[model samples]
Target: MEFYKLKANPKRLFLLDGSGALVSAFFLGLVLPSFGPLCGMPKNVLYLLSVIACIFALYSFACYFFLRRNRKPFLRGIALANLSYCFLTIALLCRYSQSLTIFGWTYFGLELFIIGILIRFELKYASVR
Candidate 1:
């Protein structure tokens, strides 16, 4: 649970999060544009979502490199940022869905699970001193 241990083993969590972020970004950036049209969201809203996704992707990439450096602040920042995104995603899903589909529920569950794991990892590995 030492900082060094967390720093050393951070790859698993980092890759998990970074990959998720990248995938989310890609969906929002590329796939969502088409999906949005089908989903009935306006072009303006779709563009806004795409912009947001691009920003999230950039942030995720930054966190990936920062975590690679093993800097405590960057680790903390990444956790916070991802947590925020998870919450926002959940809220969006709930707001948008008329009735939750299996896919929606599964995605929400996975996001929450990952957030919980990241929280535990952060606490366990955070510098005590």
Candidate 2:
């Protein structure tokens, strides 16, 4: 009449993903706007977009890290949120053609790489149950 429980170690992969998301958000929110004019972008628009990006980034990171230690539902919710932000960022960058600057391109590439790795990690461990 007793129930058993299962637990898993904290995976560093998620941490990496969280870090990447933070960096990306910082780049898009703070770094990008600060240099948007130099990059030949409209400062007002870019800065506004950067603000939005930052908000999304912070949300993603919080969701993941906050729940990663104890709640599976929260962890999954945050992971999905992070993934959504990743996709949205990519789409926004492509739509606006703002990925031309060296810094912009590099940040985008790093985010994509992190996202890919996160996905692979999830798939690899999908059968853990």
Candidate 3:
């Protein structure tokens, strides 16, 4: 689909974002610590980020439900938030470049890619185009 013309149904977009956040929260918060050291990342930092992800997930769910009436801003907010996070993660990855394993880098790349896609979708379709 052409990005300029692409528009996602608000409900579906919200569902997708909320679901992704929740899943990431679970994996990062609950499952990642055990493998952190093996992956060369600090367990404490991983743990902290995981908890932050969980908080984000909870807020996403709230936004999904509460922002239905005021959707354009909501969508914009989600996109901007994701964009900021994507950039932040990239910075963090760079800072810890020497510590991350191949798996860690690959995962970071994928995370950035997915979030970028979401930002694009939201920016393209969230407005009255």
Top candidate on TM-score is 3
* Residue runs of model 1 more than 4 Å from their true location after superposition: 1-6, 9-16, 32-53, 63-70, 127-129
lDDT of 2 by residue, 35-58 (tens): 764443345545555565466456
Better of 2 and 3 by TM-score: 3
For candidate 1, write residues 1-129 as lDDT tens digits. 344665666655555556666665565556646654354334454455556546655665566565555555655666776677667766766676664456545645675686667665654544433
Clash list (residue pairs), candidate 2: none
Error of 3 at 60 (Å): 2.3
Task: Give the C-alpha miss distance for residue 18 in model 2, angstroms.
Answer: 3.8
TM for every model, in the order presented, reads 0.59, 0.57, 0.84
Off by more than 4 A, model 3:
1-8
Positional deviation of 83 in candidate 3, in angstroms?
1.0
* Candidates' C-alpha lDDT: 0.58, 0.54, 0.71
Order of candidates by lDDT, top first?
3, 1, 2
* Cα error, candidate 1, residue 34 (Å): 3.5
